[model samples]
Target: MTVIVQPTGVSAADVIAVARGDAQVEISPAAVEAMATSRAIVDGIEASGRPVYGVSTGFGALANTSIAPERRAELQHALIRSHAAGIGAPMPREVVRAMMLLRVRSLALGRSGVRPVLAQGLVDLLNHDLTPWVPEHGSLGASGDLAPLAHCAIVLLGEGWVLGKDGSRLSAAEALRTAGLQPLELAAKEGLALINGTDGMLGMLLLAIADASHLFAMADVTTALAIEAMLGSERPFLPELHSIRPHPGQAASAANIHRLLQDSAIMDSHRDDLAHAVQDAYSMRCAPQVAGAARDTLDFVSVVAGRELVSVVDNPVVLPDGRVESTGNFHGAPLGFAADYLAIAASEVGAIAERRVDRLLDVTRSRDLPPFLSPDAGVNSGLMIAQYTAAGIVAENRRLASPASVDSLPTSGMQEDHVSMGWAAAKKLRIVLDNLTSLLAVELLSAVRGLQLRAPLAPSPAGRAAVAAVTPFAGGPGPDVFLAPVLESARAVVSGPELRAAIEEAVGQLR
Candidate 1:
């Protein structure tokens, strides 16, 4: 589908579509007007021979230096060349696309003084599936993601490397030429406007936040499935209990759990059974509270991400009335804090899932399931070591949860004092999400095994279908085998559309 890039606003869902290659983009007419107005302001500044911060002089610590008019083009080219200092592994292609989209949106707002042709080159690159090669490091996330964005800005002048549709690296000039587009000249204030922004850090964090939000919902579904597998009570999910305090997230989580477990013969049969009495432990009973907290955190993140996506985060914003005003909106502390919060929320989910995995494996805690859910308790180890793996991940998450935003090391000889380590936060959040996914998968596998041990007493319709989806790959859990395939299959169920549809269909039957 063609993705419309309107100047009205950009959404997290739009970023997801663009990143996943489901949408192509075009600039809106409003964006063109905004760009033209900003460019006119830059032209007026040049005509008056005003000494703006970056337009007529050097940047940051070198701001006092003057530039010769004859060497302006060389100065702009040198700025891009010297600032492409990023290191480490290249960023993912999807992230590159999102960065390009966000940069276009910010420029389209017209405060950055970029020419329409420069902004349109980014749109053209996206439409033709050409992504620039951006490295994972080199940004302090203050003064904008300067080094990484400089790499991105180089493509506008057709000077950097870009990956073609077939995955080969070609010069940006060659890539643009092959696509029937010419390189753009760096106009007054254009180079500074292009590179001075927070899009690099914001793009990565936005995608991470978006994925983490979906995984937060998936965590609720998986946790409810584990709760049912243990024959846990429904007292904790009652609407009356949550309605008294009524946190939106907590209420929604309770409703979701109640819907998932409704109409189950097993739940009905155990409602008054003395064998499985009044309540389950906190991990099973207070699932909503833990998952709800993560949901609330994500809601806050969405607000912050929305603002960053449309904001003009460059220095020296050119006003439509032909004036150049320098500003510091390029700092990334807001996104830094949000990314840290997301990391903590993901850590909590992993911590709870680890406890659930522990419950399912322990003979003393598993109620009636076999030791480690093994058929022959004495001869087989069953899922004994699986719990150890889950525990190790949970332990690692504690370290990952440490906030990267709170720590800042000054760079550029203290000119950039109090830096925001938001890129570090974004990178760490990605790791935390991966770890959480594995922990959830392990708990789901263990829960399915425990449910099988309680045969004849059927699980809820959603629970049964979830079991069926994993059963073909989960095969009875004997001696330790190659579990890589098992984990991959479980992740597929958690992330795939088919499983979501099955869960929704089961919810409809329950209601």
Candidate 2:
């Protein structure tokens, strides 16, 4: 089904569908009407020689230098060509799709003074699966993601390259022909409208928010597995205990752990057992507190994503009363803050998960289990080095979690000062997400192996389902074999839908 991009009704979920789900998009009739009104405003200014920025004059430091009427359209083309100065490997197809989707959505709001055909051009690319080759770098996140979005705008003019559906690089002209679409010529203010918005960074932020939501739920499932593996009690997940704190995420996470550990045979075996310090380590006891805080952070970031989805973020936005006004809505500071803050929460989640892996590797800490979860201990090295890998990734995540928003630099010959380093923040946050997935995979497999050694003491029904789902990845565990492939398979299980689906089958959907 196609997603309709109405001026004020776009949502973060819509971006995800168009970017990652192969959904075509269409601009709403209302948006077309709104854009026509705004385009009329730009045409009026052009005829009157009004000094409207980005309409009849130059950009950035040269905004004072007026462009001639005969050459104003060329100025738009030159802006697209010169500002498309991004360098580096292409961004992922999904991110590029998201960038294009968001760009069109913003313009559809009728504030950017762009021709409706300009907005339709982006939808055509998406409908035909023609992704412009947007480079991964070059967005300062001030005055929008200018350089990166300009690369996308260039493809619309048939001057640059686009990634064919088969992923082969093709000239934009060639791709347009294959898709049965024509290249659009630049119009006064249309090129600026195409590129001048916070679409790129916002797209990445929305993707990250969706990922964080998944991890928050999956974090609880994996945490429950570790608790049962440690022979730890589930008393900390008591409804009364969570109720005292009253954080929605904390309560939800605590409830999930309690539900997943329901009807546990291992827990029954430990019902009479005490003096396991009368409590598990903070890694287990405080799992909800730590992971729940990450969930809460995601909730906050989702709000920001929701607001950005429908905003008119272009510069010199055309007002309803026919005035063109320059605004700072293009600054990526809000998105930068959200990305950095989510990175910190995700890093902490991975850090705690890594600690659980360490505990499972040590004989003194692991109780009846052999050191490193190895049957042959000193001879095999079992998962000893896997713990090292998780620690390495967790450390990297901490370093990447540093705030990029605080590192603003001046650019545009100092005409633009205090740039939001949002592009970098969103980029590193993706690194954190991938690494955290790998790290959690390690913890999940370690806990699964520990519970297997416990044998006749079956885990909870939900825990059994989780273990069964993960066992095929590690081949049901054994004396050490080739461990790297096993971990990779486990990572696939953790990062994909299989593990969650398998567990949900038994538990009937997690919170």
Model 2 pairs in collision: none
Best by TM-score: 2
User: Total clashes, candidate 1?
Assistant: 0
lDDT minimum window of 10 residues, candidate 1: 502-511
**1-511 per-residue lDDT for model 2 (tens digits):** 6899887857787889999999989889999998999999889988888788999889999999989999999999999999999888888899999999999888989898989999899989889888998888899999989999999999899878887667667799888887788889888998899899889999999998888888878888888888888788799999999999999889989999998888888878877875555878999899999988998999899888888887879998999998999999999999999999999999999999999899988999877788898888877888999999999998899899989989978888888988998998998999999898898889888889988878878888867877787776676546778888888888787778877887888887887
lDDT of the candidates, in the order given: 0.80, 0.88
Model 2 segments more than 4 A misplaced: 164-168
Error of 2 at 140 (Å): 0.7
Off by over 4 Å in 1: 164-174, 477-480, 509-511
Candidate number with greatest lDDT: 2
lDDT per residue, candidate 1, 1-511, as tens digits?
A: 6666665546767777888854888788887887887788777777677788788888788787888676666777788888988887777888788878888777888888778888887788788777887888898888878888888888778888886566666798888888887777886667777788788778888888867876777787788778887778877899999999778778777888888887777677678888775778989888888888888888898889888877778788887666778887999899989989999998998899889888887888877777888877777778777778889989898899999989988877677888888878877888898888888888878888877767788888878877888889998646656777888788777666676578887675221
